[model samples]
Target: MEGIIARRVIPSDNSCLFNAVGYVMDHDKTKAPELRQVIAATVASDPAKYSQAFLGKINEEYCAWILDSEKWGGAIELAILADYYEREIAAYDIQTTRCDLYGQDRKYAERVMLIYDGLHYDALVMSPFEGAPEEFDQTIFAVQKDRTIGAVESLALNFARDQQRKRSFTDTANFTLRCGVCQIGVVGQKEAVEHAQATGHVNFQEYR
Candidate 1:
């Protein structure tokens, strides 16, 4: 573990390892050099043994500390890796559109909404979207506005996943209210309706 720790001639700051560790040696008394060596070796060998070693880490300086931790490389490495992966995923997803995935004809959207008859009064929960937020919100307001129902329940916004087994890509959608009463409706990117159906949700329409 010798030279595994990098030390430079730097002044001590609050966050620095030096200012945080300084000992006043008694000039009259002699201490064993082996004791100091043993302690240093133990700390370098494995860091998990020291609980106080990672305290004050949740502060704003945490990101910097995490990047500098001996077990891992610096934040610059992680940042580079993150950006690379993000660009790759974005490029791949760009070529695959929801319309192309769920089929240009959204014959399945109506059937997806029917599964929610039981959850009508609960919430019109929706996921976030790139383009469908305003449209979905307007649709929710349209379905629930000026009616004898709870105020338009706001659904969470989320990205649509291209579920393969169910084979539905829900990026843009409209859910009709049962009996045309409440306007509050949820728009999921793609319904895991098959999972729901397996639990005896009782499918009313065939998947065309």
Candidate 2:
């Protein structure tokens, strides 16, 4: 159901045409109740239906980073809870007109994981994809086309990408912006450049 929220999210501009990717929150609230309401309501519907609608929306602005064929492309990043969601979501296995169990499935969810394996990876892994000069950005398209192994593994791939440019990107240089109203990832992007304006570079003065 969590993944469903992301699927078929027909973007308005019709520009990217790929998955709409944007940080769901300003901070690492991907695990917070504000967002978790959607996940929690999904798995524990006593009547087998949620009493309330989920609070999240489909990210339409920066889908490129998360799903762009040139970037991570078509592949869904997995988390540890994905394993749990997969079981819970699969247990019901019945699709409703209104439930998106997230992009989590037994196969895909297996990839969902904690920011760091032992909680040592820091928030860097969970940080939004604002200025993410991703280490493993070959995309799912490339992975499939090249018959490459581990091409879609974001964590491992990112580690490699970061390792490759260790000095330029840095271990502590994650960037983000907040959604203003929701404050998703738009706060610090005062001078930040987005997917559409790759050349815009650094803080957005208008945001300030």
CA lDDT for candidate 2:
0.26
lDDT of 2 by residue, 26-58 (tens): 223223322233333333433223222321223
Q: What lDDT score goes with residue 185 in model 2? A: 48
User: For model 1, how does the per-residue alpha-carbon lDDT over 29-129 read when each residue is reduced to its tens digit?
Assistant: 12223222333344344445423444334323434343332212222221222222221000012112221111112211210000111111011222233
In order, the Cα lDDT scores of the candidates are: 0.22, 0.26
Runs of candidate 1 exceeding 4 Å displacement: 1-87, 90-165, 175-183, 186-208
Please name the candidate that would achieve the greatest lDDT relative to the true structure. Answer: 2
Poorest lDDT segment (10 consecutive residues) of candidate 1: 111-120
* RMSD of candidates 1 onward, in order: 28.0, 16.5
Q: What would the TM-scores of all predictions be?
A: 0.14, 0.23
